[model samples]
Target: METVDVIVIGAGVSGLAAARLIARGGRRVVVIEARDRVGGRVHTDRSGGHITDRGASWIHGIHESPVAAAARAFGMPMVEFTVGGYQPDSRPLTYFDARGRRLEADAVRQYAADIRTLNAALAKIIAGAGAEATYGDAVERALAEQDWDAERKERVREYNDRRAQEQYGVGMGELGAHGLDDDTVNGDEVVFPRGYDELATNLAAGLDVRLEHLASQVDRSSEGVTVVTDRGVFRARQVVITVPVGVLQAGDLLIEPPLPETHRRALGLLRMNAFEKVVLRFAERFWDAGVYGIRQLGDEGEWWHSWYDLGRLHDEPALLTFAAGPAAVATRTWADEDIVASTMAQLRRLYGDTVPDPTSAIVTRWQDDPFSRGSYAFMLPGSVGADHDDLAEPVDGVLHLAGEATWGDDPATVPGALLSGHRAAQNVLGIDIPVSELWA
Candidate 1:
């Protein structure tokens, strides 16, 4: 049996980050990954002469993001897109009804205002309500208190649903009202001109990473921890389980002696929302090149709420369609051709008949992937701060949990995952190293 000071499971950003920090502290560490490659959910696919990020792409907080920091350290090129940069005369986000009619500017402004109202109401409820109060309940209460007509209420619901799905990978119904607060550092967002995977690759350099090693069992004892995998068994003084929340929820790995009741309960509290991306490559750009994104208000079945013009970033005639939560779950049942066809139908509704069929298409099914059952973690209603803290708590000083889910303030982001890993490594080593020092 191979032994090390620390064993990091899942070579995603979190695991890699943990391993790097541990190794820097002169502790022996090894990373076991189920996939043949690293970057668990930060996969960048290059096919048909275009670079497409099959997993996460954006640096949500460019200035303070750990991912962005890593990118700069790696000398990776990044490009920033102005929100609503295109369509100078209209709102940055162009909204169209189901029949493809552009929503009036007044209606758009009203929707935006309603969103602010809903958020303010949610904030008040979260401040006073118990952990069980869901965002859905908040939305319902806010809408009921309003004097808007049925049409306006419906519009508000539709807009909120789309926002929840896009941001949290779930609808408002599944999101925890208190947890929905965005605590991320604010800055201009940017994308990797080459690929986001470069950040993962840069972090993984010189590390002892074992690919295609699926961990089946993790048995912790008084002395240390033992991780059983399909390939081999690894013994380490401490183990960092950085797998996705969905993988933990599936109970795919057997934790001998069972995890604590609190941890188990916390697992149930956090929900893994489905999210996927469909990349369509066209021979030529048909949409406005200056616009950063497009949102369809009345889409059938939430198949797609919005799309980003890759041409703006990579100078390629490609558009990436985003689907999350229920829509992402529904898309799992669709074949590639079906997904492409349906998305194309939606595009046609927006751009008219002149929109051409894509020369090639690729769809990502993160939910169906065994390694990652869903994209990331979201707080469900009835969750409390202690829930995430308990989930991240180390067991017996040997078992540690680290991932985006463990990152309370910044879940569902690369920086969150990386920060969680750093925290886990710090916990395991019993040392405090500033994040700036790590980047330095």
Candidate 2:
């Protein structure tokens, strides 16, 4: 039996970051991970002569972000994530009609303005609605009250659906109108051209990371905590559990005394969303230059609605698209060939029949991954942001919880997970630590 001052579960950014801070504070720590690799959901695939991030890809925001600060310290180069991400006004895009004909520049810009107006209107509805109201209901009422033409209404509705999938991995109706939280920074979001998982790798350096060690149970007491794993058992003065909320919800790892009532209440309200990415590579750029993003209102539900020209981040000729919520659920049993074929049909609808086949393709099925269970956390009706804080509270002041789901301000982000770890370390040390000691 091995022992340490602290034991951290899950080698994801959260766990690694907590372990790093604890170690730097002169405390012994060990990290247990079920997978052979680090960066639980920040996976980067460098196969087939391509650098593609199959999981989390953005810094969300650069200012006041620990992850961004770490990237800067490592001298890593990053470019602003300016592709038309739900909010199209951030960057110029090549817009297409249902028939694949590119829309005029003025028309595309108009859509951006319309979306902004629509978003503002929806925000007001949410603000005025009660906690029992769903975002889907708010969107529906807003759209119903609009006096726009049928064609314009249809366009905005379609774009709104796609944006819902991209942001929440589910329909707006599935999200809580009063509970949704998206805390943003003052600066632009950014991504690393090389890989997003490098942060996890660098953070894991010099730490005691036990790969392939699946934690099955945690028994806590006043004196210490005992962590039971498939490989062995270990004890520590305290343990920080950084596994995904999905894992805890599924009872994959049992806590002997169970979580506090408040923790369980919060946990019950949080849902792990289905957000998957598909990476397509071609021999050469196919779309127009100076147009980094391509959005199409395809027919038949538009399974693939948005795409980005990865060349902006040095992934030349590669395209990235996301399928979330219902779209992702619909493709749960889809094979690789089926996904590529279906996506190709959509591309052909927009790029004519002469479009060539991609040299390679990478698809993610985070929903099916047992270790992660799903991508990230989203709130349901009757839930509130304070639920995240409740879920993050340390049990008995010995069993600390930390993860993206545990962070309310910036949930479902890499920085959220990274910062949650630092907070957990602070909990373990029983003091407030400065940011310089953690990231510097």
Candidate 3:
């Protein structure tokens, strides 16, 4: 067994950040990852002369986000999309109705305002919600009491549920009424047109990384923590477990002597979420550049409810769409050809028969990934943000936890993961990392 100052498990952004900062602080750190690649959930593929991210692509928030800090630190190009997350500015949304007729710009603005009003109303329901309240129940109850017409009511319901599924990566019914236990970092969002994984690559430079070393168990004794991996055993004074919450929730990696009841209960209260993305590359652009996002209102069920103009992002003439929660899980077993054709059907509903077939396509089914099992973690009915801290609470000063799931604010975002890593590094080593290095 080899000994080091610290052993960082998983080479995702979180693990890399911890190891990099620790190593920078003059400590010996080693990172062991299961996959051959280092980015983990930020997987990017540069296939067919196009940079398509199979996993997370957006920085989620730009203001005060560690991802943005890193982008500035590394001098990476971060382009702001038109409709940026939940705080989209005054951008034109080229939306259509279920009947395939494009909605008027004023109608679109009114629809946007309606959703905002609905969310505000829902927030009040959540505030007074009982202990057993679920987001689905809260949403339905709010909708039921609304004075809006049937069409307007249906549009809000579908948009809220499906979009919530994408955001939290779980069915609304399974999520806590308090939501994902996330505090939105106030700002616009950005995406890396070059590739999302470059940040990982930049952090990995000059670090000791061992890829394809799947960690199976973590054992702690009198003096130190020992990590058992298929490649070899690594011993360290402290071990940072940066694996996904889904991995821990499923007991995929065993921690010897079992975690404390608090940690176990916290783990049990949190649920893994699945979010999958697909990119369709066409020979020519059929969508409008002025329109930031395109979606169908009043068309419910597991269909393509939303799509973004990917062509504008990188000038690749592609469209990006997603399926989350139940839809993502159900689509895991779907054939690629079937999935492609179904998405094309939705496009035809908007673009008519002249809608050409995709020249190339990229799809991701994160539910099929054994490492993550799902995308991230969402709050169950009784779970709260504090549970994340409980799970992150170090075990006997020998084990440390860092990941998006462990972070309360901005959870499930890349910046959240990176900040968690920096916190772990600072906690384990008691070193001072300039705040300027983080957000300035």
Candidate 4:
């Protein structure tokens, strides 16, 4: 068995960041990945002269995200898109209230403000000292405190539940009230230039990465942790595990002497949400060359959050359709034919007979992949931000955890994964590198 200062498991964004930082410290590092490719979930498929992102594509915000800095450092162009560009449907921009009524401009503005204020107040309550709250509780409190007519209250509750579900995939019963702040905590969303996979590949460049290596078990009984991979056994003074939260919950990997009670409990408390996208390509721009659409289907919220033009690319007929919450979960069991047919039907309703049939359609099912059981992780209401600290803590001087799941403020964002990886490496080595210096 070979030994190194640290053995980072998984070559995802977080693992790559950890390996780079640790290796920069003059420590021997080995990055073992399960897939043949370097990037874990961040994969781009290039076929027929078209590039389709199979995994993460958005930085969410360039000004505040580390992904933007990484892109700048590599001279990659970061593209910006308007939030309104992502509408629920493609045509007939009709605003529908929770009561299934078409909300006028004034009503829409009022509802939007109500949402903003409620979210802000909830965030403030969590930022201060209090028991960890879930999104359900926070919204409930907001409703109780505010004096509104029954119709308005019903509208607000329905709207909040639908959007929150679409955002995280887990409905109110399963989602954390406290987790609502994860999206806007830092205030920005940016997409990578070229593709996010490019950033991952660039980061993994020149690093010693062992691909097609699946970690089956981790032995931590010894003075150091021993990782058992399908290819070989690697012993390291410290091992940074950056696998997805869903993978950990699946118990696919064996742990010697078992993980501590605390770690196991923390893993149990964490839940994975499903967020999937389907990209349809046509020969010509069908749904109004550059227009975005939002369609509300039956007050349950959007079956697809919205559609956007692949404005970054030229001569491309592509519309990226996103599904979150129940719709996403339901699609897990759906056949490809059914998903495409249903989505196309929705497009017809929005585009009013103008939507063209897609020549090629691609749908990503991350939930089925053992390596990445789901897209990303989100906290429940009671899991306070401090729980993130507990999750990120290095254990027994041997095992360390890092990933987007452990990122507190920036969870579900690329920058958060990078920061988590850097922090995990620093924790193992007892070093403190400010966030500013990491980007520097």
What does the lDDT read for residue 395 in candidate 3? 83
Candidate 4 lDDT over residue span 91-163, tens digit each: 2345544344555757666766766666566666556523555676667777777777876776666666666
Ranking by TM-score: 2, 3, 1, 4
- Best-performing candidate as measured by lDDT: 2
lDDT of 1 by residue, 1-440 (tens): 99999999999999998999989999999999999999999999887678888988887657667777778878999887544111112336667776677878787787778766766775676677666777777777778877888877776777766667777788878788766675333667778879989978988989999999999999989999999999999999999999988888889988888889989888888877788888898989887656667777664637676887777668778888777788778778989999898889888878888899899998898888998888888887777655676778889888999988888767778888999999998999999977654555
Q: Return the lDDT, model 1, position 137.
A: 74
Give the clash total for candidate 1: 2
Identify the runs in model 1 with alpha carbons over 4 angstroms from their true place.
82-91, 104-106, 183-185, 299-301
Give Cα-based local distance difference scores for all models. Answer: 0.81, 0.84, 0.81, 0.73
For candidate 3, the per-residue lDDT at 96 reads: 80
> 41-121 in candidate 2: lDDT tens per residue?
988888867788888888866778778889888777898875524667676777887777888878888777777777778
Candidate 1 lDDT score relative to the true structure:
0.81
Score every model by TM-score: 0.93, 0.96, 0.95, 0.88
Pairs in steric clash, model 1: 86-290, 132-382
The candidate, 1 or 4, that scores higher on lDDT is 1
Best by TM-score: 2
Tens-digit lDDT string for candidate 3 (1-440): 99999999999989998888888888899999999999999988987788988888887668777678778888888887745353322456677887788888788777778778888788788888887889888888888777899888877777777767868877778889876446454566678888889889988988999999999999986588999999889999999999998898778899987888988888887777878888889989888777767777665335686788886668668888887787677788898877788888888888788999999888787888999888888888977677777777878888889998888766777877897898898888776786345423
